[model samples]
Target chain A: MPKVTIDGHEIEVSQGTTIMQATKQLAIEVPYYCWHPGLSVAGNCRMCLVDVEGPPKPQIACYTQVTEGMVVHTQSEKAKKARKGTLEFLLSNHPLDCPVCDQAGECDLQNFYMDHGQYDSRFDEQKHKKKKAQPVGENVMLDQERCVLCSRCVRFCDEITGTGELGIVNRGSHEEITVFPGKEVNNAYSGNVVDICPVGALTDRDFRFKCRVWYLSSQDSVCPGCSQGCNIRIDSNLSRPQHGEGERVMRLKPRENLNVNDYWMCDEGRYNYNFIDRNRIQTASRVKEGVVEEILFEDAVDSLASVLGDAVREQRHGRIGVLVSTQLTNEDLFFVKKFFKTNLGMDAVESRFSFPEGSSDDFLIKADKSPNTAGAQALEVIASGTYQSGEDLIDKTIAGEFDVLISFGVDIDGLLGKEKLDAILEKVTLLAYVGSNHNETSKKAQLVIPSTVYAEKDGTFTNVHGRVQRIWPAFPPLGQARPEWQIICDLSEKTGFSVSADDAESIFSEITQTVSSFQGLSYEKLGKEGSLLSTVKETVEK
Target chain B: MEIPEELKKKWDEAVARYEEKRAALLPVLRLSQDHFGYISAEVEEAVAHYMGTTPVHIREVVTFYELFHTKPVGKNNIQFCHTLACNLNGCEPLIKQLKEKIGIKEGETSSDGKYSFSRAECLGACEMAPMMKINKDIYGPLDKDKLNEIIENL
Candidate 1:
């Protein structure tokens, strides 16, 4: 341990600790662009100037290691003037296009300006201009004018993503961040470049101009787009009274938790919420004799219980099939399985656990599309088929002479090629489809229950790696839709298996009590930040 | 390109004031560019290899930190910082007038290679943007005619 005095505050830090680390530990963040926790240090910004007691010239705290009895002043007049000078010089060539920059509120340059600006423009000359924006990747846009040349995003690609696509082209102030000749900045983690850019230099092609960050209400959640379930922050402006009132998530960013995806999220997860935002089939409408009439959720549930219950009671238990999607939350999966097994005494709860294969990146994630196949497996939910797995549920549906079958899912029909699913649905006498989207199965269902989208539902999704993460509701349920857990609980009451399902805790307990893999997983333990419940892994070290 | 033994020895002595081999990037770039009008890939590669880093890393520093060069240039590098505050005062016309006076475009080297004009990001002189740096000399607070006169005299 070493004793260091930073800004007159005496502090003790571990040996070999940099002055930058000490500053951060002391709740004093040194403004920098080139130094990221995950990457090697390249102190190019020079904005993190500090007056070390012994050094005649100011040292960049990012690279300077703290020694015993060392004194550092980050707020000294000399240090202040030095940082201000650095900022002013940076601004001389910078185009203050904050109005146009997508990274406006969250930009580091903006933060540094407010912290160090002398409130005076010293330049009596013209500003240098560069290209406004260049689309560098499938999901990344580079604005050369807004770039401070800190090279954080460029470093992120080379070091973390291992994709050495982005580089600095040309030279001097004429220098701009660009990809190498003939190569676009296309990498699986290319979106992370937009996240790391200190200035508005790199912007996401997907999130540009959707809504300003100041207006976004953020909620901690995990990406259900894949089994990796990278922890994320869902930012939205849905709480605004001006917009058609509903908490609509505008963007998804990686929350900085070293345990999960470290400051990086896949573009698929970040952009997948767009479908959920607009296409929520949130109404119980039945086309009886082509006269489509909207019915209340209660009436629909009652009818569903009676018809399915009578059909199952008459025909038999195994004849009534059930489909549970891997996309369903742990609580949702538990109750859906329970509704068939306990209430109907029907054991044909066919597993809807399947998706198209996605390629993995060098960063922290699996390419598997469904977030919770492993959890579904724990609940005895088998994959429908190998290649097109969810279709096996329908394959079994065709072979098994069933009177009624209940399938619950989102993205099931899309997974099970449209024609095949449609043809299978025609043969079934009674079909109940529950999901967030109006897929082909939902359209053919005798009863359709609109389940809350992952963003609007608070529950748990077990990622492919067996990491159980908490996905919280970013907004209120849309159009009388309920969380799958609540709806399944409602069905339980109607069918004579009465149980309360007020909170995720109650439902989770029922799951852990019966389910072997989820034995220790309690709602209280399933933190808002999320915990990985992997059956395959060993330690919690990232 | 091989440096003279005298200057190389001098640089070696002066390098220790800074920490790490990479800290010498600015001085090395300036010295090389000064000795032989510009910095080529050969010199940058040799330096980077010796520094135990990639050429791209050194290239990023040279491209970013204003004090480095990556291409062949004229004897004098003429850089003008035309940013927002500077533009408000009148740099647009000044640059246009300078182009006419010098008979050269903004990013072009003179036919004789005696002078090359380019843009500087900030030059640490925001107060003097719309300002021109000729080699090491900085001149600001100018009208279009003033730039015309200055380059004409040069």
Candidate 2:
């Protein structure tokens, strides 16, 4: 270990650790632009220049390794002057349009300028102008005039995704970042560039001009887009009701979790948040003679409970069937087993239902499109060796084997063709749907009980890796909708079945007690970064 | 356009001279520029292919150096030195006179495709102050009459 002194604080670090990494241990703020922990160091930005005791001039801390007994100063007079000069040169060509820039509130250039820069303008020459508002990819927009030539976006494309669609063309003051003549940055992880960009140079095309970032409130959550449960922060527009589509969620930003996404998330998960507010089933509804009528959620729950109670009491449990989805959390799935399988003795409960096939890559995207298939597998809801696919569940319903059928966020039309799904709906006497979105299955159900999306609930989703991560609620369940776990608990209460759990935490506590893979875990144990089920089992054995 | 196998063989030899493949970029670019007069976008793409790098990286190096031309520069390439030494020795008016005589601005080629003019950095001939390099030759201590005569001879 090499010992280095930074700003009067002595710390020992590994052999190859840089001054910037050492300063991070001492809680010293060394402003940087091009130095991303996830990407390779280019050392182009001079913002992290620090004054060393021996060196004649300030050295760039990003690539300068700390030698043994080296003394460094990040806030010395020389260091501050060097950073001011670097900032002045960086801002020489940057346009003064922060009022209209989408990244104004969260941009590093704006933040660093407030922290380190207050210098008067000495430049009398006209600023160099370049292209602005160029759509670089399917999801990213480019404003060349605002760029500081950091090459972080370029490095992100070249190193992280290994898709080198971006490059710095020209030289010196005339240099600009752009793509090839006809190519676009349409990679699977193209949206990550906007997050890594330190200035207003790159912006999200979907979120640009939607709402000011200052007005958006962020809550910690996990992306339910795919089985690779990327940690995310849900940014919602609670202040502005009249924003686009009346959507509460403004955007989804990837949170840094080294075990999972590592400060980068796929474009599919980053933009999959529109469904949180679009086409949502806000209130419970009942269909009669092909006419839909809005009814109270309690009435729908009571009616479902009575039918389930009748089937269990009359020894007709074989007539009751439940089709579940992997979109439901682990707690929700656990409650489904306790109520329908354990209490009602329904043998036909299946959660092997499939979602639409999504495109995937080796990096972050998973072909299994749902978030919690492993959760269902861990709970044995999709029991091993049965291999009963979602199609088999639909086939049983179509054959009139079950008089009552309930779906939990399973879009039957998406799984089967519309005509085949309609045939199944006609065969079942009481078709009930409990989901947030309005799909073909929700539309034709005799009784529809609304459920909350992953954003509007607090639960744990066991990702494909068997890692149970937590998701905190970003908003209250929209309108009269409730989380699926709470809905299941209500149905259990009305059907003369006693459930020991009331909320998501209690349901998860019950799961930890029952499931072998989750024996020694709790909500506090599975913090932001989740614990793998295999590791949890090992800990319990120890 | 595809790069020739002969040129690619030279590039392979150049890459073997350096420990890292990226260090051979300048030598490889020089080989392409020697075989093909100037580096077009297609030539840049082909060179990047031969170098096993991206075009933007090659483009950055190509545009940074004064020797590598991106476009064709006719029969006579005139490089007017415009550094501090040449400017202090009154080279600005002479550069203006030379551009006027050639019927072109800086970085512009002649309409007849016979001449090219570009303002260059210090050409290392400050002793012969107020100098301009034409093709393979350097002319210096230039006045209005001397610059016009050089252009006339070209």
**Cα deviation of B6, candidate 2, in Å:** 4.1
- The alpha-carbon RMSD values of the candidates against the true structure, listed in the order shown, are 8.9, 2.6
Write model 1 residue lDDT over A1-542, tens digit each, in one string. Answer: 88999988999998889989999999986788788887888898889999999879999999999899999999899898889989988888888889988889998888988998756888888877787778887898888888888888878877886666777866666877776434687777778888888889889888787777888888888888877778898888864646423437677888876767777887777777866667777887666775656788898888877776666667665666677777788888877777776666665676644456787764555667777777787776543223134456567677655666677874446776777666666767777777787767677666788888888777788766566777788878788788888887787778677655888767788877877777787667877555555355656534
lDDT of 2 by residue, A324-395 (tens): 898999988988887887887767778976566789878788889899998998897852233386678678
lDDT score for residue A466 of model 1 = 67
Report the CA-based lDDT of candidate 1 relative to the real structure: 0.75
Clashing residue pairs, candidate 2? none
Off-target runs (Cα >4 Å) in candidate 1 are A8-10, A239-247, A290-292, A312-315, A352-354, A382-392, A410-412, A534-542, B1-154
Who wins the lDDT comparison? 2
Q: Which candidate is the best by DockQ?
A: 2
